[model samples]
Target: MSLNFDPQWLSRYPAQEPVGGAVSSCVFCGIACGDVEAHVLAETADTLCFLDHLPATYGHVLVVPKQHFQDLLDIPEESFQHVMATAKQVANALRDSCGASGINLVHATGQAAHQTVFHFHVHVVPRYDGDSIVVFPRLADPTRKHEVAQRLRTALNAPQPPKTEAESSQA
Candidate 1:
């Protein structure tokens, strides 16, 4: 596919820690340590599902392997199966809980594709006719991309507070 580029937005990103480096440099590794408002749907030795912060809609969620893997090819076949199965379960829950018509599953790999966090996550964004969520358009302006990454970084770095009974189900 032909790609379009925008330079202005790309200029705003802060220099981030490298992906798949020493354990301390891993961003996803830190996610569980804080109370960053993740609505964790399920967790297992192999995988976890949690609500997406930048939801395409209310029920947008993400599924990932518990073990950090930077890209799709890096995931072992069994772990991939477990992650996908959990994603499917979450999508069904979204339909029941949020009245979603359908879901969109997505993943990005490497810096060029904007997989900023460097963790293999499958996004299960719910779809409705009037909802803002849609598939990729492939025109990356630096402004919005930078803004999104900044927002996510802020959320990821936020403090961990204690959880309530209602909030405990997802965790």
Candidate 2:
């Protein structure tokens, strides 16, 4: 190996998938089951958080439920709360320790929506000004949002999806 350093050297290295040669069939399941190696930051009865192997930004973290759930549609109330609370804790640390200007608490549900991993996980991405990365997220226009709202409202009434922590606790 040459002693000379190149800032672009890291880019030349191919990204490793889910920490490489995971023991379980499902990568995240391997992590959750402690069959895969990771720099685990936090672990709770229902959740586990660790640094991303291929981070989108500095201090990027992936928070996941220890119990397997492919997507948001089936996550139970308590498990969901554990993931959300853990994400909040990681986000605050990024702001306080890493000087993040903002944060994106991102979750993708399906493959078409860009959910690459089938296991449910939340990305607590830290952002800084002048940073090239963008989640490219936007909100619906308030005027037109009612159309979207009505569609969700109808779906909300019908059920295959379960309730969230707040929803279940309130009932």
Candidate 3:
């Protein structure tokens, strides 16, 4: 079976720098550092919330850590918590201001998850009735629920590995 694929497809997206290291080429890092212009919404010492230029909805907002982190796994626990708090605040504001009935807090981690930006960010998408935006369209396989749960439980209960030098330094 020949699959039509382009190995260089990732090159079309922005270059990703190392975790915890800020690079000029990273647009999110630039925005967080005040080097790039973005529609500012809320700013805290550890996080920044801004309007997405290409919004999924009318009041789409992005909450990100000021310090560069490639994705969820790379971000420190404290920083990730702060980002989540800021995202909660943004979500509330979006719901209240936009009169949205519901909100979707999305955080895509890698290329397979459609995360275009390398920075760790949570997209606060305000939703209304019949918006036609389908984030998760997959039907659940009820038979595999217990099997999946057990796998997840096992992984969650497993002992955590020691952090590397770079990871320790970041913390």
1-171: candidate 2 lDDT, tens digit per residue: 334332342465343233223425667788888789988998888889999887878999999998777778867777788899999999999999999999999898775555666678999999999887645434345698789889999998876768789987765
**Candidate maximizing TM-score:** 3
lDDT per residue as tens, model 3, 83-163:
999988987887778898899999978777667788889989999999988776555678999999999999999999999
lDDT of each: 0.73, 0.79, 0.83
> Sort by TM-score, best first: what order?
3, 2, 1
Model 3 scores worst on lDDT over the 10 consecutive residues at 1-10
Task: Kindly report which residue stretches of model 2 are placed more than 4 angstroms away from their true locations once superposed.
Answer: 1-24, 137-146, 157-171
Q: Write the per-residue lDDT of candidate 1 for residues 7-90, one digit (tens) a residue.
A: 443355443544544545655555654434466778877787887765657777888887777678677677789989988888
| lDDT computed for candidate 1 | 0.73
Model 1 clashes, total count: 4
Candidates 1 and 3: which is better by lDDT? Answer: 3
Q: How displaced is residue 106 in candidate 2, in Å?
A: 0.7
Pick by lDDT: which candidate is best?
Answer: 3
